[model samples]
Target: MHHHDNPPQSVPSSPAYIRATWGGTGSVEEASAAFGFSRAKGYDLVRRGEFPCRVLRIGRSTRVVTASLLRVLDSGEPEYSGTRDAHTAPA
Candidate 1:
């Protein structure tokens, strides 16, 4: 008989779960997963400075503002204007 060393990985949580659990804000990974994006792709977007929503970088941690995400979801338009300065974190 074949033996498995590791168990199957659990499925990623849904957007509704992230919204319900995180409320007004969430990690970039969670937001990306909610939008059906892989964590690597999400971070890649942030690294390339091409993320379409408001991303706040607190030290090394990145958060996605739910209000801005909601706005994008509602209007189907990204708030980014191709300006790196626009993505600066608050002081």
Candidate 2:
């Protein structure tokens, strides 16, 4: 028999969960990293409403909901279209 220290599990990261806890608002870095996007591209998306638009702005920070990102990923909604070659942003 084989012994395992940890069992396989499925779970999103803690920050991802927390950011969506209050509906929507993810740290720029977290959101960027979550979707394998660069900081600059992430900010641009935030501003362009390309991804899930930030529900609120707090001081100098912004947050994006994980749901918005998921929606774009999960569905083929025309509004959430992306031009892969046109932008160096990550998938």
Candidate 3:
């Protein structure tokens, strides 16, 4: 048996679902899950100021901009970069 205080929610990687969640703001964990990374990696990106999307920080909490997340997903690119990397670059 397992007991958890706050269990992770299923975050669908759909634009419609994202647009409807939290009125345009989501937690770092949710964003990370959608991006296929661990929550710790997401927070590490935030701490290092390298997160792919725009973030709103207040006190000790961080929130990812829904629009930015959507942009990253829809465009297949990180918001911070104008050029694609080796994985996405042309041959």
Candidate 4:
């Protein structure tokens, strides 16, 4: 079990909420919260290079790439964004 002075923010899974709430980058805690996990686990994943999305380490600070996080969240979509329609025949 893990504990924190401040719990992570429970961001909605919707893309619109992600776009509206986060900028180009956000904290690892926020990313973990989006996935319904603890920040410690998130940091562990980051250290092991197994995080679900891209993470950048600048000096002692770690930042999650919002675009990568959003991509991970959008994985359930039938077709990737900017890709051809899934039901359409190839040209």
TM-score winner: 3
TM-score of 2: 0.48
The lDDT values for all models are 0.70, 0.55, 0.77, 0.73
TM-scores, each model vs. reference? 0.64, 0.48, 0.69, 0.66
Per-residue lDDT of model 4, residues 1-91, tens digit only: 8678795665465567788888998899988888778999988877656678877778999888889888887793321221223453433
Q: Give the runs in model 4 whose Cα sits over 4 Å from its true position.
A: 1-14, 76-91
- lDDT tens readout by residue for model 3, 3-74: 788856645756767876656789999888888899999998776666888788878888888989899988
Model 3 Cα shift for residue 33 (angstroms): 0.6
| Model 2 C-alpha lDDT per residue in residues 53-72, reported as the tens digit of each score | 33245688676655665554
Better of 1 and 3 by TM-score: 3
TM-score (C-alpha, index-matched) for candidate 4: 0.66
Q: For model 1, where is the 10-residue window of minimal lDDT?
A: 9-18
Displacement of the residue 18 alpha carbon in candidate 3, Å: 0.8
Cα distance off (Å), candidate 4, residue 38: 0.6
Question: What does the lDDT come to for candidate 2?
Answer: 0.55
Clashing residue pairs in all predictions, respectively, total 0, 2, 0, 0
**For model 3, the run of ten residues with the poorest summed lDDT:** 81-90
| lDDT of model 3 at position 19 | 75
Off by over 4 Å in 2: 8-24, 52-55, 70-91
